[model samples]
Target: MIDMLVNLYELPDSSELYQRLEEQGIILRRANAYERHIVADWVGAHFSPKWVSEVKVAFSRQPITCFIATREKEVLGFACIETTAKGFYGPTGVGEDARGTGIGKALLFRSMEALKDNGYVYGVIGGVGPREFYQKTIGAIEIPNSDPGIYRDILPD
Candidate 1:
């Protein structure tokens, strides 16, 4: 197994990640759902603040985990991990520019490790990218998109 190492920064440490990200000119951040412009700009998508506002509210009701990635002291990527009631990794990302370079795998591994540490022995990647990456990089299984998510697990022996 390719266990990728990632430094888990608390919400406060997020500032450091943002600072580093700013230096690299990567404008990604773990903003609240109400912050749509920030996310739009980060994803290069034309979205309205209304979407951000709506999502923020939805996020509060659901299990949402967010994080930012920095390269050389600049924000390179941001991710949102929305967990299912059954404990799955959902809605993950490694910014467009930050794709490859093992960032996705690193992010996925870090998130899964964290989940595992928290007693979640399983995870799923939902509404994300590169299906092959999930399987090849972390040995995740590709279930039918019945739940429309990439479900993977580290079961307790």
Candidate 2:
């Protein structure tokens, strides 16, 4: 006889899960205008200040949502959502201290679920990390980038 043990985790609803995030020193609230500016500055140090500014403006103009992970109310991680005529997805980041904890996956799943719920028929994500995760979890595929600098699709067949 062989014995196997599988541990199952239950994901809470948005409100309850958010409470848990609070308890864990994390917060999944929408990023405000100024905070977006701050994020732009911080991330710009490595990426691009122009790109950061673009994202901040984009968030304001569209349904760009963010779920931020925090500790002591300080940002630890964040997932960005951009919803357009095309689809919805993330350019998510997990802090050095928050990686390897399934936070990114959760953020990805949440984004996809929201997209699906909003009646999106397909999703094409830019970049790589979430693309790979989508491939494994939702049967996403890497398609040729229609435009330069973009590459991957997580849409249903």
Q: Model 1 over residues 49-115: C-alpha lDDT tens digits?
A: 4323333432464233544455555445544444343344534445565665455554555556556
What is the Cα-based TM-score of model 1? Answer: 0.52
**Colliding pairs, model 1:** 20-73, 20-74, 21-74, 21-75, 24-74, 89-124
Residue lDDT tens for model 2, 132-153: 4555555566655333343335
Best by TM-score: 2
RMSD of 2: 9.6
Minimum summed lDDT over a 10-residue window in model 2 is located at: 1-10
Q: Which ten residues in a row have the lowest lDDT in candidate 1?
A: 3-12
